[model samples]
Target: MKFATALLLIISYIAVASAHMAMLWPTPRGGFGTKQYNGRIHAFIGYKDNVWKVRFPCGGYAPGPITKMKAGQTINVRFYASGMRASDIKKQPVLTKSTKQFHQARHGGGMCEFSLSYDGGKTFHLIGRYTNTCPDAYFKWPVKIPSNVPSCTHDKCLFVWSWTANILPQYYMNCADIRLEGSKDGKLPSQSIQIVDFKNRKMNVKELGDGIKHRASTGPTKKEISGNLSGNIPKALKKA
Candidate 1:
């Protein structure tokens, strides 16, 4: 019995380590109820693996609740990095502290995009993009809706969150269902995001780094907050 229990423990740890980030707010389809572990309020909606993420759009989730949002408004979207709720994690392991706990892996913070798809997941229009220091400690992001985005009350609107890891050849995506209230202008974005291809294309590490360097500016300082990080630690990211 003891040997069997040990095997179970090993399996559990491996499951956690393999899984990555997922959306927490606005409620994606299937309503954050993945087959794996649940987060603070709901289970994470990330794909089981990198291949699973790229193989399907919106993590292959069905439509859930519809968030009625207005155009040109900035809303804070929440995420669970590494399938563990960021709120329940520490920057480092507990050997350095008295408390015993797990830490979320940042993966060196990569480029993230918040795109809108009026026609399901067919095509996505780039609404907001962030580089360098995305998915910070809290894993919550501020995304602004473009005033030119047309309302989607008549049909369904898919709000997608895509991230390309800078250090690893990993890509994560989560999509939410939203019903947009028309803006004063009531126009659509002139161009769609060309770079975000839904094909089974995974960007190599060199490509990810090049994209970051190309768009590099006086962006947020890179914070080394991986669970495996040792030595000096930076300031805790302010809560969202």
Candidate 2:
């Protein structure tokens, strides 16, 4: 009886630990959950020194299949902020549930950003961002690719999704291997690709200890940069 009870306790702990958001579309570095490993769905959800989570890029996951995309295309990014159901992992694009219950796992709809990396996840360029009420009950969000973004091959390109919770200091990220189909190795000006820390709340780009500045190279004025709310986060998240 004691052995059976201990097994039950272990399973319960894993379920609670793994109850978090997951990237659904563009199919993150690792695919959705499995019967034996449901925690794989939340593999990229990071908190402080969680190693595979906030501390490492792509949650320390290796690259998966490459998705080919165009420079100026609108891609639908999907996420499951709500708790997962058995049916959620059975299909592609992840079917949305109509249930009315609010899952606190949504983290009160936090800020989300879409970025692209050309240097094997060393640096990222912000392409689009959404603040405040993001990733609500609605699971799908559309991200428009900027026209001037450069083309990249499979190994060098990564599409990254980052979120900072409004109710919790927790940070989450997922990366998808992608290749941009276009011509000419045109690079955007330094002002356009701001080098910011989408990593974890504990560390910034400079803290990586690589001596890389944590801001844009050319240093655009504060008025020019958009959707950056680094220091001023919601009070609830701070206290949490």
TM-scores for all candidates? 0.62, 0.64
Q: Estimate every model's Cα lDDT from 0 to 1.
A: 0.52, 0.53
Best by lDDT: 2
Residues 34-71, candidate 2, lDDT per residue (tens digit)? 12223444533444334234435776667777788987
Number of the top candidate by TM-score?
2
* Residue 219, candidate 1: alpha-carbon lDDT: 31
What is the TM-score of candidate 1?
Answer: 0.62
Measured on C-alpha atoms, candidate 2 has an lDDT of: 0.53
RMSD of each: 10.6, 11.0
